[model samples]
Target: MTDYDIIIVGAGPAGLCAAIETGKEAKVLVLDRKQEIGCPKRCAEGLSLRWFKKMNLKPKKEWAVQEIKGAELYTPNGKSIKMKAKKAEGYVLERKIFEKELAIEAVKKGAKILMKNQVIGAEKKDNEIELIVEENKEKKKITCKIVIACDGVDSLTAKMLGLNTKLDLKETDSGYQYEMTGITGYDENLLHLFFGTDIAPRGYIWIFPKRKGTANVGIGIGAYEKETAKYYLDKWIKTQDGLKNGSIIEVNAGVIPVGGFLEKMQADNLLVAGDAGHMVDPIHGGGIGIAMEGGRLAGKHAIKAIKENKFSEKDLSEYTKEWYKLSGNDLKRRLKGRHLLEKLTNDDFNYLVDSINVEEALRIGNGTLTKKDKTILFTKKLITRPKLLKLMIEYARD
Candidate 1:
């Protein structure tokens, strides 16, 4: 048995961040099932630089796949609008390099890294958690004072521990993306989004450029009872311009929990970070920042629990509290917006595209909402129609 003060499963951003923080205060062991670190990337790799600036972290040269100035949004009717940010907009990260750097940072801080180790299950007894990890046809046990489950969306650890991981179909977004070369259209380093039922059906399509000639183009659909992301992606690709002439470099499928943050995200001597805790922004489907933030909080709280010699569920709730304190209201507001999106018809969205043009022209003259730079844009139906807003208010209030 290998003993550690804290054991983190998964080597992605959340897991690596947790390992980094925990290793500073205690002996930490980090494990990943994958043989190579950060190979076979799963994300669209877009991240806001604003979040990194606030954390006082600088992106290395390898981290930048491209620098972005802003984003352009397209409604279902083919209407488009572009928004440039006042500050540096974001980065399209090289996830392979980004993930590897996190592991390197953890190793620099004295955490042990185990590659190709699959944690099949864990046992909890006497206030300690014993993890069963498999590597190369051999099984091993790792005992630790606390377990941080930073596994991605479909986490076995959370399921095995009896945490509520069930997602309402309406609350889940099924997504598929392709990495491609020879992509056309100008590389503004701008992320492009296409929204409407016919296009994405309660979800949306995105194109995030990583280089001059390469991009990650993907689509997501609301989790309907019988539909899968592949089905939606296939249908959507046929309608995209850049992808029509491009060849697929790689493909990825993943689920995002966009309904809202988990009502509960902690258990006895354990904490869930990232998608396992449903920390993604409901509106944008961007999660790395929130996931890293959750990982940081989980690491700090785990250190506190170890120092206090208490690993009760109650003690672990501190991470939950801090996560909510940091991200709760934002997620809630976005969830409200997301729910409104689910109810919108394609025609409604089209009407909205025309309405926004009117509103933008009017705002330019008076400079009211346009002056403030509409952070959240409600469609014409949501604004002109009181009934829809009332419905959204009711849903949000619940």
Candidate 2:
């Protein structure tokens, strides 16, 4: 039996970040079911340096794989468009090193980290929560005034508390990824994205280079009936030109929730952050940055509530406000954008691709899109396909 001021479950980026922040002021306990930190990595490991600066954290050299300069977009018909970054873009992180670094930082700040502790469930009573953990076939209970469930998507801890953890069908996505070692002819600084019905019906395929000769190629598809992520990924790997010859080193399957925000993320004595709260970006299905943002807010809010001796739903509402302010509006806009993408038919996609090429050519010839350019592009796209324009209008309104 151990009494701690705060207990954080899960040792992912979000959980480790929470421990690092809260441990500065309180007796924090960080628990992970895994035997070692950063094992069984599932992330695509893509992050921008701008976020690191905004959060006041420096990037450790050992954790960064490569610096990305831009992203290349490929339409369904194999036509490509490269969007060169204007600034130092992002990084392909070595997640194993990244996760361990955060854990070590938390430990240095006086947080007690308990590895191999599997949290079975939790019990809330008298304004406090007791965590039931099992390690080495022995049962132990951790009592704490605050519990932050930084567990990844579909968190059992949030469900055990009877919280609202449902994701809408349209807002949910299934992911399949592979890390390859023998791939060649890949640009370390440029990531590639494939879009179309065959590649991904409602989503897209991504090729993110991790190192000089290695890359993480993956695809995310909307969760639909009788349509599995594995099936599509297997088919795409074989047919897609870029990945047809690459050897698969490792494969991972995961789900991302892109639906709007959950109704309630905080309870009497518990707070949920990161994927447990479904905070991933709706358009790109990226969760690393959003999870870090959520964890940062949760840490700050939890400290405020604990210091005031008031851990209520009202007190934790501040966390939700800060989260929305940081990324909620973007999530809302992207959710609508995802819907528009889903409504596009094969013909609509072809038309849109051609329209983009024409627009790009015009932009290249002139500096940027002028009023006449906008009018010409808009009229051509609208007259050619009314439904696509309708969908675009819907997203614009959102």
Candidate 3:
């Protein structure tokens, strides 16, 4: 058996980031099931400039492929609202390159990354956690003082370690995406979103351009929706002139944990981060930045745990406390907004399209409303629509 101070599962943003931090002081190892890192991209790849600044990331032309100036939101009736502002500026990333670069940085920090390694089982030994990993069909046991499970939605590692990371169907979103090429008629510098019950069923379709003629076209819908995410995505594509003839070079399906955040994200000698802990935005199903933040925090706390030689659940709970303070409270509020949006009908959506301006739309979409913003939303924008007003009042309450 081999020994490491910390073992991070999943080489995506979350695992690699945790390794980057923990590697600075402790011996760290990152393992992923994928044969090639970032080959099967599972995200829309739209990360905001705000997150870029928060994460202290410098945009690289090699991976930050497209600069997004704004977003275009469309109603079921096809009315569009263009939201362009300095705060909204961001980028579409070439995630394959970006993730590989993250791995390199983690390695530079002295973390070891082993690809084609799948952790099939985990058990708590006397003071360390032993992980049974399969490498090239050979099974081996590795002992680590702590385990950070970043295995994403449907995290098996969390369960294997006796943590309940199960997600309710209502709290999970079915995501389907296609890397498309040779598409036209949309602005390459802006992200596009289309919303309707018939279109997405409690979610939206997104187009994040990676280049002049290529984009990531995807849809996120309730996991229990009668129609599948791909079904709705394909239906919408057939109606669009720009996307109907586009070629799909790659396709992937995944689940997003929109809510159902774990109140306790740690167990004895184990920690869960990223999608494994439901550290995703409830409204948009965006997890990359949130996952990275979770990983970084977990890494920091894990270091402390190692220093004190305290790997108990009580000792590791500080990470969960800080995560709630940093993101959980706000995400819980956003969950209310998501619930409200779920109740909107096609007519209500179209009504909302005409009621709000670009700024309010952005606020509502991002779930960043203030007391003043809520007051204005209810008093002015939703005044006439009593149904929507009631809905907004119900959800807008803090």
Candidate 4:
């Protein structure tokens, strides 16, 4: 049996970030089921530079493949709106490389990492958490003062702890992506987003360039769609001149939890971060930044609890409180916005694209519109579409 101050169940960005923070003053150990870190890649790999700046970290050249200057949004009627801003510029990363670098940083901070290990069960004993893990085809027991479940959307740790991480079908998006080579006619410094019922049903399609000649072409569909993501992605790819002849070098698929952050992310001696806690952006499906933030916050509070020698649910509630203070309102607004969007029809989207300019579209996407801006936009929209306005009001109240 092995023991540590903290044991993280997943080796993704969130788990690694927690280890890096907690390892500063606590004995931290991270475990993953994969033999190698960042394997079986399953993300679009786009990250905003704003997050890196906010985190006081520099963009790593080795992990970055392309710098994005802006994004183009295409409506159902083929009208496009381009959005560009200093804060919106980002990078398309090689996620495998990025995740590995995070793990290396955590180790450098004195965190021990054990790959090819899966935590099968967890139990609370006194002030410590006992974890049953499978390593090398054998079951092993490890004890820890605290456990952070940074596991992905289907987190077994959260389930073991009896946390309500259940996601309704409507709250999740089925996503699929193809890393293609020999692709042409794409702006290497820009992202393209296509929205239409025919293209992606209730969700959207995205083209995130990785390099001059390669890109991560993907589509996400709401669970309400009967067709699979691959079907829609393939259908859209056929209509694209640049991607029709491109060769797929890699394929990745995953579920994105966009329901909103879980109301509760902690239990005695345990904290849940990342997708397990549903920290993903409801509108854009961006999670890497939020997941890391959650992990860092979890680590900070966990350390505080350890120093006080208190590992109760009440003691760990500080993590949830702090996280809400930082991002709670923003997340609530996003959920409201997503709900409003879900009520729109194809024609409604077309009307919106025709009515709003690039800057307005960007503001909506970034959720940076001022109250006055929204009032003006909504007043004009309501005059033209009273039914939609009623639905928006309903969503807002909800």
Candidate 5:
């Protein structure tokens, strides 16, 4: 019984960013099932300085709780490589506040946000899409010229609109985390990453400090693993003398789509972004920045569609093409690198860590590293180790 120029599902970073971009030029309404903007966050809340500059975000002391100076990577044998640099610096945020800030920007741009309103059903015609929203105890249908789906991993809006966003088990990773206070025995300034098949399988364990005594301790592992992510996390925490006594204030678990980037993100009057589109970093599984970027692009294109009065799939597909050129290709390359990393044995991990010097590690942490034809060639170590080099070459086959 209502109408809008654009309707956005979910009020996460992606949806809010989309609203910010489209609200200025069109009548945009955003709906979320939550009572508040950000509550019970599902992420580790770490963001790099590069992203802050890229998104033109000013870090507020209220939400940017802790600044990370660098990272310390650990191998299976316990060998550690510390990477520190200006570009490697970032922050661990109070995500609940950060997301709320994004929402404020969206509202300031003239977007109307309806919290606790869930999109229960959707229907699309040749031009406009109608959404059935459930608020309180009543259902109301709202029609819009376009619908942007930013609902997380279990998104139903896109599927209802006929966009398949299902992810295979191999493409997804199981993440489990605990926000612990009274944590100690680690640098509050550097991110800690532990990697090993026995430790986390194809993923890694992270400790991102939010304060001097509090941190988000988490792990990501193969979704198909017989042992759950919590099992590994709990097992590892018990071994950590300092973390063993920390009090957990919150527990978060979810499925992260690390691969399987969708080539098509749009239908006639529908576009998908964020985790719903599998737009996550394959290696690190970070999605907040990427999701916001994707959302911004979606909003930008939605403006074009509304201005030109064109809503066809082809017309809206400029977003998809632009996304690929902007980030898709780089993410694809990282995915390949992730696949190669997954094949490395624990010994290979130890050897690689041993081979990497502090400077080389810093380059990687600062985002100054990429592979040429020798994808696994980080140090000149691969050239000296024929067996490892051959294994990498064999797996590098696309």
Candidate 6:
């Protein structure tokens, strides 16, 4: 048997971030099921640069494939609105390279990583947690003072800990993406989003440009939809001039839990971060940034608990408290906005686009509307459709 101060499952952004932080002051081990770190990419790979700055990390050119200056939103009727940021541009990354770099950074900070290893079971005994793992075709047990579950959406670690990891069909989104090259007639510096029932059902379609001639084209639909994501994606692609002749270089599919963060993320001697904890943004489906933030905060609090020699749920409550302080309210409001948007029809989307400019539309779509912005939008909606005032009031309360 081997032992370590901390053991993290998954080698994605969140797990590696936790390992890097915890390894600075304690023995840390990270386990991933993949033979190589960051294998089988499953993300759109679009992230804002602000997250990098927030973590005090620099964006490396090696993994950053393209810089995005702005985004365009398209309604079902083909009406379009464009929003451009003056600064803090987003980037399309090679996720495989980015995740590997994170793992490499964690390893450089004295963390040990076991690739091709998976945790099959976890149990709490005495003051430590024991993990049963299958490594290199051998079953082994390892003990650790604390365990951080950063596994993906279908997290066995969270389930083993007896946490409520259940996700309703409505709360999850089925997503599929294709990396296509030999594309033309696309603004390489702009990301595009198409919204409508026909385009993506209750969800949306996104085109995130990678290199000059390549882009990640994907569709995410609410799990209640009967059709598969690939079906909608293929149908939408046939109508796009740029992607009609594009050759698919890669295909990836995954699920995203858009239900906001879990109510509780910590139990006795254990903490859950990343998608496993449902840290995804319910409105935008952006989770990479939130995952890293959750991991860093969890790792920091874990170190504090280690120093105090206290691992009870009460002692670890600080992680949940601090994490909510960081993003709790924002996520709640976003979830409310998402629910409200789902009630809108294609005509409603078209009306919204025709009524507002790019900046105002973006503010509404991104759920960053100020109180004054809300009041104005509400007044306009009330004037146009009196029945919607009740729903607007409900959304405002959220």
Please tell me which predicted candidate would have the highest lDDT against the true structure.
3
The C-alpha lDDT values of all candidates are 0.78, 0.78, 0.90, 0.85, 0.87, 0.85
TM-scores of the models, in the order given: 0.89, 0.91, 0.96, 0.95, 0.94, 0.96
Q: Tell me the tens digit of each residue's lDDT in model 2 across 342-386.
A: 778767766776676644543422224456655665677566677
lDDT of 3 by residue, 1-398 (tens): 33999999999889988998888899999999989888787799988887898789999999999999998888899888877766438899999999999999999999999999999999998889999999989999999999999988857998999899999787999999999999999998889989998889889999999999899999999988898889999999999999999999899889999998899999999999999999999988888899898999999999999999999999999989999999888898788778988999999889887777777766775677778988888888789889989988877666
Clashing pairs in 4: none
Model 2, residue 120: what's the lDDT?
A: 94
What is the lDDT for 11 in model 1? 86
Rate residue 336 of model 3 by lDDT: 79
lDDT of 5: 0.87
Better of 5 and 6 by TM-score: 6
Lowest lDDT block of 10, candidate 3: 81-90
Model 1 scores a TM of: 0.89
Candidate 2: stretches off by over 4 Å: 240-242, 357-380
**After superposition, candidate 1 runs with Cα above 4 Å error:** 225-227, 357-398
Per-model root-mean-square deviation over C-alphas: 4.2, 3.6, 1.7, 1.9, 2.5, 1.6
Candidate 2 or 3, higher lDDT?
3
Compared with the true structure, model 2 gives a TM-score of 0.91
Query: In candidate 6, how many clashes are counted?
Result: 0
Model 2, position 289: C-alpha lDDT score:
79
Q: Give the TM-score of candidate 6.
A: 0.96
Model 2 lDDT-worst window of ten: 360-369
List ranges where model 6 is wrong by over 4 Å: 86-88, 365-368
Query: Which portions of model 4 miss their true places by more than 4 Å?
Result: 85-88, 363-371, 395-398
